[model samples]
Target: MPRARPPLVTVADVRAALWSLVSTAAGLGVAIALVDGVHATNPWSVLLAALVVGVGDALLRAPLRRLARAGGAVGALVLGLGAQVLVVWAALTFLPGITSTSWTAVLAVLVVAGVVMACGHWVLGARDNAYVVGDLLRRARRAAGLPRAALRTAAGPDGAGDDGSGPAADERPAGVLVVMLDGVARPTLEHALQAGLAPTLDRWLGSGSHRLESWWARVPCTTPASTLGLLHGTTDAVPAFRWWSRRLGRMVVTNRPADAAAVERGASDGRGLLADGGVAVSTMFSGDAPTSLLVMSRASEGLGPGQLFVRFFASPFVLVRAVAGTVGETLKELYQGWQQVVRGVRPRVSRRGWYPVLRAVTNVLLRDLNTALVAEQLVRGAPVVCVDLVDYDEIAHHAGPLRPEALRALEGLDRVLGLWEEIARGAPRRYRVVVVSDHGQSLGDTFEQVVGRSFGDEVRRLLRERPPARDVAPRGAASRRGRSDGEAWGPANTALHALRPGRAGEGRVLVGPDRDVPPGPPAEGASATPPAAQPEVAVIGSGNLGMVWFCREPRRLGAAEVALRWPALVPGLLASPAVGLVVVHDDEGPVAHGPGGTHHLASGLVSGRDPLAGYGSRARADLVRVAGLEDAGDLVVVSAVGPLGRVHALEELVGSHGGLGGAQCEALLLYPDDLVVPDDERDDVDGTRMLVGAEAVHRRLVGWLAQLGLREGA
Candidate 1:
């Protein structure tokens, strides 16, 4: 037999535990209720988050107490905060389906809540040793001024070079260099320019080869949508990514964004939908296809846009982590391999700038940049080279886009861009550079703002109604009556058996709920009548994705449109202060409109040229000419308002794009009048045209190439 163990806890322990529980319960209830009162979330969602927190807290109490005694109060606080961060981070990462906002925000909220609870221990003096430790750590951190410290510059690899002799340039350029900027909204750029924050662009414009005007952006205004427009030069309405699977004929929404592997996994899982005996082709995922990806015939022939997207990139997360781990190792190895490459470059530059926070993410960017840079160097390139930087979007999500830290990150990115420009300038006469952002940044906590307050009382009440029961033994019979009762309505057996059947014939109908069934003889001539119809009860609202009436009608606009158009709903919901954007699905697509900062609408255009100018008119004509009869856009609207939208106080996000009337919808055209390129010469060009602008420029470029006698593929 096992030895008997001493009692783990005593009477005093029990009392403390009980007090903690009660205090915690009360505090959590008040917090959640207040959050609800502020219209943070509907009653049910608030209750759920509270329950999770409560259970999580209970499970952690023992460790917390032990840590308090060992670490001192200050140490205990740090322990608690650390524990909370880990727990919340794991929950958000592993079970993202349950996460309403980004993991960063969830971790923040969890820490704040845990800290507030630990303060109770301080006031109660439940654990003095731990409190002291926590205080010490706090003071130490404050004294160190850790939060505001500037990051150090990172060292480059010994052989990493800017002289165009690096491995990135191993592959020769293929004449034409096409760079696609995924979310560049013209209005957003104009707003940034008008704000006077970017002076570099003004100079670029003054250099010529610039055309800024109303260029139609991709429909749905997503990365995929915009990218497709640039690649295929058409808006086919075939979504690049969607929750609905035609093969499975079902809706399968994911809590997390799908990477390249996930797309293939989905295809494999749905293999049952494939046509007879054909093995899955490897070439499909290898970027071997040549023609446009939008044509139905090509899509059916195993050349799909889905496969193409995956072929060009690896999983983003994996790339980031690998890059981070290799940095220290790579620098050491490179320094040993090449002395000249390390001559002026610092060994620490690899560890500096955005490298520290983005240690895990910088690898993919390195590969992407290296590939573009190297390819262009080895092969002679065309006149224009467009470079698309998507890191801004990713950085903004983890750290607020415009936050000082994020700006610092952007500065690092700008430096990298400068590096690329420096390399291209080596062959300046042969290349022209254009750099841009897809859209602007907005700030806000994603989750709490959406789920904090929503749903109607009427909807909730309707869902809670119970159905009535039927079937019982006959009553008032001698065989069924109890000893003390004379012909009682119920029997004296089990609780359920005790009930008796009501009157037959006329009483069966029960015209009103208040009316009782009339008593009747149990003979052959009588039959029970049916009950009258019950009135419909009002419904109470329950949960939503941030919209005012989500649960009431989640199916109002269908699912696919919602998934594509309203990505913010999943990441921007909050359960406090009732701040967030509302996404509503429509026949056209998911339409978002709310008070908080989010890109709920398409942006406007920005142009130095008149709307009625020559090329501008021609561009308009081309748009009308290219649209097919079946999938043609019904109406095109230009928002007179600039890309910058109104910013509300009490919200973190300052701006948004994609609304109906905004500057984000506009395009910047920089085609010099003297250099009108022919359409035939613009084969390497990507993205849709501002007909007048693009075609004119194309004609001009073609003419220059003709003067040089360069052929399409030569």
Candidate 2:
């Protein structure tokens, strides 16, 4: 039998094709204006050139898209540029009016064309374009009987809801979706919205459906701690991002998969916010979610083919768009870094090295991945979804938190939020979107820059210096003077010697044990020097917060013992104007010593200006509470706030956190106005009233889920 004639293209297809053509033509016109050698001469000539280029693009679109998809984003960008160059060459060779000087000029034209195309895509809604393609691909796959199964199902405590069947579209329960924009402060976001950098967020706030409220992050405000608290409703023993774990016998970096898993185990109580069939994307912890993507806690497990990856890679153009987008973003980061240098923007850290590439990956590739995965979850009718985007946090770390580059990151996130809102409207279940941040960042110069030495170096100097006269006196005499000279004579003294082996003035203080430590029994006990006192003093910096551990000691020492061993240590730290508050375990309990001030946490007594005064009301409580954690440092050092609110970071970060001061603790939460806050109690901090702690934020989110009848009981 003869084959039936192919069906005619629909009106919608024709309209889409025309729109694509117009967009390409407009982009070509822009390229023509930008390239030096290319001369349009007149509006007619420009129009003619655009038409030729657009026709050529349309003719080769299918093959080019296939090639681009295979090559990924970077490859596609290169291919597109090459193709554009060839088209321009053909146009200049055949057209009468269009002219170019040389091949170099053609290359420039192609570059400009690529940039224009990218800009056009961004302006005309890039995510929307991807969404349309993804939706079509999904529908096509479903129709082919290759339906993608939902990765997880909601199960009540008794497993009553464990059936594989999904809720019908209309019968689907209301869901809550939380988007955590890491490291964005409430004030910073407010300024961005006022400055028109974040129009989408501004619109959301103005729509009356959402309300913007500021809350306080717990002490040692950081991603790992705040995220853990937000997800599991407890920060607990997570004192800092990286710390000396006595139990692990090594430093624990929170981003490391093993350490993250361990930390989550310590903090999670099995009933995380996403415990019941929720989805977590790009988060530090999985929140005990059944479906998780790029979660640090589960990163050790080999990633498998899943719905998110399937949906993300379904469209050939998505990968190409991501690559092209990353390239453009990388160029922008370089330009922004250069501009900062030219403008002599102070308090800015070096933006060289792999940072530009990292920023591109974060702002483009990772962002696209998160957005696609979240969209997939929404489509699959997840009960609750939580996604953390680190684009702003990564940028704000090197660049000042409020710099243009960081603000641009915020704008990009706002665009993603808009996309999610659009997707949620047609989702199987009604979703109430909430935007929150793990913690805010404080901008400042690093302590090393201001003090001419790192916190570790200074501490080493104190350890190397000869003990005070009282410390060197006879043990009985020292005891009479209320000093325990034991630290100077015991294993701590051996650690000091190990730390400064080549005499006090010759070698730098040992930050950690020598990497070349002899293997296997130290060569038959060849004068084994007490295992060389590995990490005599562990000084880990979490933003502006500094944690110092006297590692040689078997157990944590109090302030008196520390003073007796290294008398100049506390004095030296306090001498530096950059040092803010130093909290240590004293005989009386945890005592916070600030510049010319001291506060006894146990008694709630202040000797000088209340050290925790401007740090917020919960600051004292939070600091004391964190100090008591088993993993907390022997002495916790917080950077002093300058007159302009800048805090000196312990690390080499310009924008710092992990301690109180300024916007570091001031996080924001944007939720639907109809959602009820769990506590709603005002925390008065130095006369400023606000919500305190990520734990409260967690409760509020859980309450929202409960209110939607998604939980076991409302």
Candidate 3:
């Protein structure tokens, strides 16, 4: 855990002091110009008053914030705006710019200053990011946990390139920074680079300092599965993002903290990508890193909005900047969504209800926080640092992956990458930066929108059944809202969940939670789970992939038995134009049935039309791998892929992933040019050698660590 930051007047302190001085000066100037509340003896008195006000806040604000956080309904990570206002009031009362006798006039200045300053920052548009960027960079040096006295540097926020005169190097191995830009495909990144959206990376690649290679994100192409392989070097993590854990008799949605921990325990065996000495930031799994920030699996580590993260968040104008960004981003989403509807953009999902808010939080707040935490570790010379930037992935889910809003979010992620690059210049030891994506998103209309009903509803229609008592996915929107539950560990309410006075232990993953939980167990199966005690079959997943599980069966049901039971369910699903294939375990092994023919997996026999036709060359192998997992569903359904690379998502996302279709599996890896790949792990794809599967990518990453002398071997 990161220790409490010591009190010192450092770079961040100076910059914050400066920004406050300016903002407060502006506020006091407005009061002196427009009101009779403040009287200045001389011109310098306004500046003096601003500095005095900053000092007052510096002294009294924290205590008032603590009191409010402890005494009221306000969350721990709340802005403490009231406390700040109080400090401003108290400071102005004693300053030459204000009279202590006029409380009403003081109140007038407070409201006017608050509104005007907030408006000023908001209208500053993109320039407003300076607040977060400068604040984080300032805190980065101090947060690195290295000595401050000798850490003089020419490379920093205001400058670049190390001066070779700083803190003495420790006798430790060089480090690697592995960054994941979630749901960004290889092609998308190429487009971004070409469009000059990611100038730094483009320059690096052009300068021959980096090599961008295409990779594959295999079947069950979801964050949980890919994250597991990337962090733990294991492929058989949970069967899907949400799965029935037979051992634990509960539905495991890896997005949930406790469930994430369970999945990590099942996959990890002591050593992981960051196991030696590193940090994991804003990722699903910890990679066995000694320090984990915003990692779901390590919720017990208990950093959250507690003192450590709060100090970083509570820094002057950091939260205000985020709040302003959040508001602007939310409005942008609303306007964009409205424009999409008005312009009749096809294959779009509704960005209504809580989506706009979620998008703003993910893109603005989480992105900034994750960047800050990762930058801190880099400056500290950590052996391995892994971080995830979900800005693109989150927005692309609602807005189409190629839409302007989503691409704009992608551009912001690129800027963050550039910031990290800039920060890396001053590190004590040399570091190789490797950037990759967990999975890519495919765009199209949702399955429900296409068919005018959900897969669950379709299954129920075929089987003459009603909704299960407590199904994880409801009959509505296949893009179940629960996937947005990020992590319990953060600095704000959106970021941190454990803020309630007595409910700190029960972290809030709630905004619009329709968590994927299973139906009640069958009366017969001893090892089955049900949310409310009603036994029934379930059709889950809201992406391109859908899974059918029979709660009545203790073990997975075979194709022959399923045909014997609900004979119409299989044939009914196969009949839908939205469905491409129905995969089920057969007597001869797993069999895939398409509209035209059947493909037998075990012997690679095609009775007629090959079921894996347009899905891609790797579809068969990917399906074979997923179908063979221990907890795979009784039947797997994949939406049809159109010639235009369009897919019908099982859930309610305009852009989606989780099965074979389009660019969803087309991931990328941008690594340092010096890293070499062995011949055996490379597979030829379209005449270019590409790394296949998440496990293969993991091996390559491990090799890089060994090559850097951070670990024993690849």
Candidate 4:
């Protein structure tokens, strides 16, 4: 038996396996570099990563194989891939920023690395192929799909090939600008893109640009989701509004992490983050006090970036909605303030005009974004300049989209764009500019009027259900039952219950839990239970209704259950013909259910269009189909091209985007003949359509660039 024992696997075998794995990874990486001659990492660093991967594979091969055999080969691939990625990541992690200059050098280095990796794979590793290598390349390409050239239509149909026939990509253009008009759907934007509003855009369309359709926006039409998607170039791990109220007990509009932090803090302190105490209670009625002052005064000093932003915008309307409960609180404040004034006590000046307040908020937001843009330009100095205007959106929300106010806002944004173009033109550089929108808007009524339901009624009903609810009190418990009657003592749980009978002396029977006094015998002298009280419900119209219920306390049920309420609330609202969508919220922000409720965020970008078109699609996602850069929309609601498609309309909020409607989802991409061809057919890039505008424009641009021979300086 001993003599018949087979030879044991040796270190040489393990080494071979390790080398194969290394070669496999290297090969794939090289393939990526060759195709897209842009690397955020240096060639030396990449090589170093390759070497580390080789070493790591050698060390982990036996273990990995054993684990793979035990955990399945699929598991092994996962483990191997993870390790390889880690090695590459580690190599780049400690390094500073990366820059790329020479395409030839990059392509050559990638090729060598890829070949070595392939050899290593062949020797020691698994059965990954050139196809696998290509897959990895595709992933990288998708990640970097949003390129300045692609955005500006400078890439052409085949996508900026590195050949002597074409004009040097460097000589093609300097500043490439892309502006998105959020919520302007495909059909809506297409009409305008086809119409000659901007001469540059018109040229692109006339030349036949490659066109791509059907990229989905994330839910909810929130700016964070849309902008982040645009910046990241994909829809994975989107930044959606956190719906569950963890900290404040109820969700109005808080992001996820904030909700979690609120819950945790509430648990620790035995208090809800939403607990107003004195300040929150005071500001609701008259809207005078610095509502967030109390919260900020007590918060920790070293807050994170998000917390900092929240802290900056923590007003009452910005914070919690306590209209009903705060009535008493407001009375108290007025009384106190009057006493102070009579006694010659004066507080500081107030910035409280409604219009001025709106203006101030917009101004601050504009200033912040502008500062960020300027700083980025100064630091990066990239050839492309993308500007997103929010003026149209701001005015559209406050004033109807079609109103003069909204138009004024659009004009202002145009002025800003004009100034930007002027600056670009004056500079010693050439730039190509493109503008787009996700959807268009409708005009008619307000969100409340269109939906025919009162959010106030819903709030009251919810409070009545739990009379101990802060907003409602039970019927006549105090008057019917004297303070001395302990047996009859009970809180007036709801406003309806507050009118009920209490004890022996109590006259008429009323709605409440316990009797404070004996109810008078029924009219016929028979002891009978009184009829249940019914709270009056306000009129609910044909349009939709949205309810945002904030929780009063932080609990596990608070987060999960409150968010779940959106499902129950939306169906009823959607029953109306005019009510197509409903978005509910609690402490976590917007809690939505149904196919239309929970979705990706919409873009906050503004488009360059006629005033009518620009304001209509303010908050919708901006669906961008350009390659090399991320599209600006998260959710796109496409509406019909014409007025017959009109459903629900409002004044302050007549239209919004975030759904996959005809108008909000579809958009236009106009490019120049020197840049693209507008083609309707979708091109598969890693199984996803990577369509541009049209074929003719793409061909013309490619041909023109090739004839120019700028790569060889002909």
Q: What is each predicted model's overall lDDT from 0 to 1? A: 0.29, 0.67, 0.69, 0.31
Which lDDT tens digits does candidate 3 get at residues 1-714?
Answer: 323454555655666668768876786677666767566666577788777665655575466546544333233345445544565566667665456447667666665564456667666664425444454455545543333333323332212223322222232236788999889999888888777788767876876667888888888888888989999988786577666645445455555555566678878888899998878888888899887776777654543333324433544445555666677788988999999999999877777876788788888777777776676677667878899888888888878888888888877887787677656654555567889998898998888787887777787788766766755446223535323322111223323432332443343332344322432222223444342453466567636888877755667889898888888988899899899999998888999999899999888999999988998878888888898898788898899999988898877777888898889988989887668877789886546778987889998998888887888544
Worst 10 contiguous positions by lDDT, candidate 1: 486-495
Cα lDDT tens digits, model 4, 1-714, are 111222244343345446544544455356445644445454555555555544654465445545554433224435654554444444334434433345454434433554444345346543222122221222222322332233234333222322311223343334344455444444433443444333333333444532324333433333333433342222222222222112212211111112212323322222211221111110001011112211111122111122112211221011111111123223433443345346542211111223233333332333233322322231222343333444444334333344444454444344344333323322222344445442344333333343343333433344344333232112221111111111011111111121221321222222221222223231222123221221221111111112132323222223245336433334444343444433332344322223333422222222332211321332222222210011111111122222443433211233443332334333334333345433354443224443322222223222333343311221
Cα RMSDs, all models: 27.1, 12.5, 5.9, 26.4
lDDT of 2 at 612: 75
Model 4: lowest-lDDT 10 consecutive positions: 280-289
Least lDDT summed over 10 consecutive residues: which range in candidate 3?
482-491
- TM-scores, all models, native as reference: 0.34, 0.73, 0.84, 0.36
- Full ranking by lDDT: 3, 2, 4, 1
lDDT of 1 by residue, 1-714 (tens): 321332444443355445544544443334333332222234444344444443554476555655555433234435555555555444433432233346556544443343444445446764211221221222222222221111011101111123333222222221222233323345544544564433344434544334454444332333333332332222333221211222222211111111211232322322111111111111111111132221111222222222222211221111222233335324533442244235532211112232233322332333232333322331223333333344344333333334333343344343343333333322212233333233333333221122332122211222343322221111111011111111010111101111112211221212111112222221222123322221121111001111121211212334354345444432332212332333333344433332322221222122333331212222333223322112121111111222233211111122223322232234343332223434453322125444322323323333433443332322
lDDT score of model 1?
A: 0.29
Which candidate model has the greater lDDT, 2 or 4?
2
lDDT of 2 by residue, 1-714 (tens): 322332244334455556655655666677778878777766667666667765675576556656654443334445655666677678755687788888987766655665576667778666333432345323322322222222112211111123422223234457888899999999999999999988767765765657888888888788888899899998876888766655544555554444566678878888898998898887878889887766766654422123235434433234445767888788888888889889999887777665677678778877887787787787777888999888888888878899888998898888787666545544556677888998898899888778876666666677775323321111111011111111011111222332332442221212111211111121111223342444566676777788887655667899999999888888789888788889998888999998788999889999987777666567778888889888899999888887677898876678888887878888998887667664456576556666788888888778777877866645
